[model samples]
Target: MSIFKKIKGTFQLLKTIDLDQLAKLNEKIDLSDAIKNLGELDERQLKGLMKMLTTKAKKGQHQLPPIDGDFYNLDLKLSKEDRDIQLQVRNFMEDEVKPLVNDHWNRAKFPFQIIEKFAKLNIAGIAYEGYGCANKSFLLEGIIAQELARVDVSISTFFGVHSGLAMGSIYLCGSEEQKQEWLPAMQRLEKIGAFGLTEPNVGSAVAGGMETTCKRIDGNWILNGQKKWIGNATFADVIIIWARDEDSNQVKGFLVRKENPGFKAEKMEDKMALRIVQNAIITLTNCSVPESDRLQNANSFKDTAKVLQMTRAGVAWQAVGCARGAYEAALKYTKKREQFGRPIASFQLIQNHLVEMVSNLTAMQTLCFRLSELQDQKLLTDEHASLAKVFCSMRTRDVVGRAREVMGGNGILLEYDVARFVADAEAIYSYEGTKEINSLIVGRAITGYSAFVN
Candidate 1:
């Protein structure tokens, strides 16, 4: 019998039998034997016993409440259609991606087979308004990002590179003809894309220190530089390359095709986090492209900042997902793991850890929600995105650390899931913009001072 049913039966016996009456009944009959006799008793006797137990159980109904992290019922705020999409994405991640993620992550290989299945969700460029996009709100986009990262950060990164960084580059800066040519097929997963901006020598300082150079000659542009940590670049059909024009000294974006004779992308290996993402070290040696292939509106680094501002909010959402995944897994394990004849969750210290994890998770969810609201309203600024990124990434590290602490040794094992988040959190902390860089962004906005070297 369930412990709950046993407790209810004991309570019912206590209410009717005093110590003297119980002693007299015990003398007349063994409790175990009486229970067996009762089982074999007539239907009327069984009904009486069951009725007593049910009554006691009804009184104890609220003792063990359901486990739900979103205590505030934030889900109720979502539209029915949006909530359905959120559940669909969550189900997809739990069923399809969760089972095979650790193995692929250990092997550091992209699961190309799942691309077709993922595309069927029709979530790429979800918030964009045109070119076969879903035209969903930014709230839905944030939910999708969380769902993706909850299962595997690498897949989330790959999706962000193609759907957000690369496709967003076109959506925000490319000509109308370019969007019509690329966005539709790309949305359908017929053409994959990559973004190439950070170079070997220039990462956070790429704005003014971009070493990637583009020289215009004979109606063609020759791109010559190396891009490091370029996710999906090796197999991408088209790469959005950002480089400084040699003559104008202003950064410009170009649509560099994979078949270009001078373009070479080699796989970067031995990564400790986001291992399933196939980051590439790309070398451009006079990679020739027609002038028409250049991004029409990308006149300067300010244009690139617009794309980063949009996607950085998504990264914060991804961090929240990572933390939530770790917390849930740890919470479930603690309730079942036993020590000294009791559940570990019963201990005050373990509960403290769980509470702390949930607190951080709740804060992150609320912050990301507001951040997406600002985005949907078109009121989001660089400082807003940076602040969210800074806070969420930092808090995620804390949540994952507590998750690991509560799980004990199993936390370090990949099969348990929390270990991967711990490692992946490190990568999220550094990418897009480092903690130092993101903090500087907020500092500059609030203080009206530039701390970065120009």
Candidate 2:
């Protein structure tokens, strides 16, 4: 090369290193002397020196591995179209929901503005057939739940209340006429729904101890009771209220409209978790519903279990997402967060926590994958769903706890995002089915004995 060309190339190479790096290099060698010596070198020798310096400059700047929670490559099991849909939902959550999550979650408010964009996704009731549903496999539905919760558990809870519990109730138990009337609108996200099964005094034992009562009066059902912790109830267009019938003494479901004069929903406040979800304490004082609005096929708690069974699987997947989000966030933070003049991720203890988090996350993902498969095959039982819910929720708590531990004090800060996951994991652990309750369900199946009661 010519003298001018060699000097220009040398200057261009120098531009790649910042002043700090250049200063560090100068401490080791005299830069002016090095440049003068470089001019004397032959063309081949100059090229060799440039290559050596370039490699040396890039030595400490190793490329970081991508922040993916799917450690086992489970997504490879999905087809091209399925993978595309997953990416679409993931992008929507990252671009549209994630930016607003911390703020909304802290303020205990919902961002109603995203409804239009969310509606365009057309994912409600995805696993069901007809009634404007996607007729997709249950595996896809679980994956969608995971993707949503991976960003924010509150948003996932909102979607689950509307699509899984509320819509599933109408789909699995409602009459054909009711399905034609409500499913189309709900599937489009034009109408929101809520499920009301737990009450102020009823939770795990709600199956038999449900205090809500429904009476047939004048060809209509009168619902009288309160439902606590009803997600989306404050603004739901319709709520599936499960009550014991005065006549049949069996659990029945009624479609209670929000506009009913006797129907009232009070927003629950001071929540420590899932603040973005508008949980409500609903009161039904003589709330009357037409016979047409009643769930025709829901005659007992056994029928109600159908909806819970399907939704429980989704809850397990939500736990997986919650753990994953924490793991990825912590992983990213560790690599960038410097301590003792080195990245924390390089520390043995920090790496141990990350490995544990990923291991639990991977196990949860594979378990849910099989759980969904059983669901799609129509061979899933209450015990199968319960087992996954129990395992994943418990593991998620451990993962999130370690995530917070690794971050030290920043893990408790909401801005870092790990704190939110820590709190949300608690909710997931207790909500769909508590660790104790779900464990009993599985224990009953294995032992052929019901230990729920004495």
Candidate 3:
């Protein structure tokens, strides 16, 4: 409280500021005169003055909020172990996958080099038991899907086709012998798999109007048809092909090897979205498969529906990731982008766009959370999965559109990252189940009426 102590404290505070800042302050006011007046002030006044000056000096040095997109703190709901796994997968995507995505996507090529590293994650078929899988909850599987698509949608699509559609078919419908034969290797990423269901002439209606046919000859089934838009078909070691039986007219599934004499997969080019995924037009000309390779449990369309129902939930999660990546990218861009000599994030209109994007992103995340919970509880119905696919895919389009809008011209450029998300969202909107088709599935459940045309 002595004059000497006050002067000493003032000097100490002055030392905390740099020379440049002191010069700037001197321009605004007389520094020597201010110090003379400060010596005349009471102890309390001097203390207050010192605090004010120190706070002002550190104004722009305050820490900014983290760049996380999980606005609702949903990760707190996960267990420590589950949370660790989530972080591990997130780190893998951000570290290994992100740097290479734009280049691979622009070139319309898959980075086959990363397959070995990706296999180290050991996440494939995580929800299923045995066969060297992790046997974790379906929620973890959904989270993995979200994390994968958060960095690159094409990689997520490739994973979904292999782990969800291909392995799921064998797990749910394959004979125990067949599962024992393929799943362990597939889980280790030693053998990649693909699903062939959508045909050249049929997509949503393939259940009843399938053109692919199989006949039993000399105890071997002969399959003849073409499957279009088959993800990973070009290099998959195995493909789960669905064909109609000539005798019973019921749909059946066969495990067709890529080395089969009559099987062919040609890469489809000129795609606008998910360019990193190797989608192929598969042709089967009397592809012969032994009876032992047939999926014993997949007897009708209902069996195939089971696989679709499961993967549809995964697709919904993918949409959430796509939207999340775009939102985060745009948010970061806004905070750093300046216009009129100030950050655009400081403007009212930019904040509004950011708020809207996060709102939709949060809603989609919560919805998918509950959807995965239902799957974990074994209560997920086709309608539940379909409704989620419809809602999330629709909302994803809105979130990505706003993301692109906020970035203006830069949003269209691939280097900005939002542009890739914008293009990929269109593919998510149409695939897995179109909005109209999924809505009808939900409508049928609610109204107790089948509106689907035969």
Off by over 4 Å in 2: 1-57
Name the lDDT of candidate 2. Answer: 0.91
lDDT per model, in order? 0.88, 0.91, 0.91
Clashes of each: 0, 0, 0
lDDT of candidate 1 at residue 38, scale 0 to 100: 55
Cand. 2 TM to true fold? 0.87
Q: Candidate 1, residue 453: CA error in Å?
A: 3.0
lDDT of 2 by residue, 157-242 (tens): 99999999999999999999999999999999999999999888867568888899999999988999999999999999999999
lDDT of 2 at 296: 98
Between candidates 1 and 3, the TM-score winner: 3
90-203 per-residue lDDT for model 1 (tens digits)? 767877888899999999999898899889888999999989999999888998898789878888899999999999999999999999999999999989999999889767
Model 3, 178-242: lDDT tens digits are: 99999999999999999999888877578779999999999999999899999999999999999
